[model samples]
Target: MSIYEKIGGEAAVDAAVDIFYRKVLADDRINEFFDTVDMESQHTKQKAFLTMAFGGPNSYTGKDMREAHKNMKLTEDHFNAVAENLVATLQDLNVGQEEIDAIIAVCLTVKDDVLNV
Candidate 1:
């Protein structure tokens, strides 16, 4: 099975996105970046992106990571905050460490792009 399947596929990815965003929005450190954003649309985009990233069958047609985040002047702290939320959300849903590690690794691959470094 693909890692997506192993990590519970569509349903799990959807739930993790939902939970992860809640944490992100609630966080004062990162909440400012989303003040004027459309969350529902962002949610949809995130779901598709993560599904594809995790070896699932989905086409992510959103802006590329660098372009998407280029104007944000994002820092490592912002990235870490977002990643922490993701990890916590997955852990809350009982995803295994191995799977979580894989997820984190995949997320890390885009760090430079996200930070525009």
Candidate 2:
């Protein structure tokens, strides 16, 4: 099955994103990046990105992650924080370890896309 199917689907993606963004918005280190963003819109974009990355039907079609994050000067520290947040969100949502690992593998595949360090 595709990763999307494995992870559930749109509903699951939506839930994961909602939880992830709530944490990100409240996180001091990453909050600055989202301060001026429309939370709903940003959340939608993130959903699209994650869905596409995980083999869902949606097309991401957003700016390249590297370009979108270039100005932020993202580093390993920032990436690790995001990863931790993701793991927590997955656990909170009761996603299985196998599924979570699949999702995380997708994220890891794009490390260069979101980090400069």
Candidate 3:
């Protein structure tokens, strides 16, 4: 089974995304990066991306992560902050430690794309 299926599928992903974004948006440190986007669309795209990234059926045709984040001048510090928020969100949701590790592994796999600094 795909990682997505293994982890309770769409409902799980949706929950993760919701909690993750809530932390992200409320974070004064990172909110500016998202100030320009329409949050509804951002949420939709995030879910789609996570769905595909975890081997779900959906196709994430979104822009390449590096290019998508290039304009933001993302640095390692920003990426770590986001990762921290994601990890905390997962913990708050009571997701399994293994699942949390898996998510972090996946995020680490994409770090090169999200952090050029």
Candidate 4:
């Protein structure tokens, strides 16, 4: 089964996104990247992106990772910070370690793209 289905699908994605954003916003390490962002819109986009990434419904039509974060000048530290927050979010939701590792593996696939390297 898809990780989405394994983790309770839409509702789980929604909850994770919301909690993840809260953590991101509170995180001094990477919060500056979102200073001017329209968080509501960002949240929606994130939900779609994660859903697609997790092999659920693919309604995501956003820019590719490179284009989406090209101007941000993200570094490995920034990427790690986000990854940490994501792991925390999943853990907070009581997702199993295997699923969290799987989810992060998927996120890692776009690391170079997000960093524009």
Candidate 5:
């Protein structure tokens, strides 16, 4: 089964996105990047992105990571901050470490693109 299904599919993704965004918004290190963002849209995009990333369903039609973040001037610190928030969000939701690791592994695949490296 895909990690998405193993982790409870849509409901899990929804909860994780909500909690993750709250954490990201509260994080001083990365919150500045989202100051002008439309969070509702962000949330929707995130859900679709994660769902696809987790091998659930592919409804993600947003820009590729490199293109999407090319203008953001994101640094390693910013990336790390987001990763930390993701970890914390999963932990808060009682997701198992192995699954969290799997999820993070999926995220890591986009790191270079996200960092525009």
Candidate 6:
């Protein structure tokens, strides 16, 4: 089975995104970036993005990472904060370390794109 399937597929992705964003919005380090965002819409987009990233389906219809985050002046600190939020969210959901490590590896591959580097 795919890693997505191993981690319980769409339902698990949905829950992770929900919990992830909640922590993100509450985080002073990154909350400011989302102040003008429509979180409900963002939540839906994240669900799709992560679904694809986790190998569930190629169904994300949002902007590409570089285009999406371009001109946002994202720094490594911001990136780390987001990563931390993701890890904490998965941990809170009782996802195993091996799965989390695999997920983080996938995420790390997108860092340059997301940072517009």
Among these predictions, the greatest lDDT belongs to 4
Q: Which numbered prediction scores highest in TM-score against the true structure?
A: 4
Candidate 6 versus truth, CA RMSD in Å, comes to 1.9
lDDT of 4 by residue, 39-98 (tens): 889898778767866668874332477788877889999999999998999899999999
What tens-digit string does per-residue lDDT give for candidate 6 at 32-99?
98999888898887787677667788744334888888999999999999989988998998988998
Between prediction 2 and prediction 6, the one with superior TM-score is 6
Model 2 clash pairs are none
Residue range with the least summed lDDT across 10 consecutive positions in model 4: 57-66
- Looking at candidate 2, the ten consecutive residues that score lowest on lDDT are 58-67
lDDT of 6 at 43: 88
Candidate 2 Cα errors over 4 Å, as ranges:
61-63
Clashing pairs in 1: none
Q: For model 5, how does the per-residue alpha-carbon lDDT over 46-82 read when each residue is reduced to its tens digit?
A: 7776676666887443347778888788998999899
lDDT of 6 at 21: 86
2 versus 5: better lDDT goes to: 5
Q: For model 4, name the residue pairs that clash.
A: none
TM-scores of the candidates in the order shown: 0.90, 0.86, 0.84, 0.92, 0.91, 0.91
Clash tally, candidates in order = 0, 0, 0, 0, 0, 0
Off by over 4 Å in 3: 58-63
* CA lDDT, every model vs. true structure: 0.83, 0.79, 0.78, 0.86, 0.84, 0.84
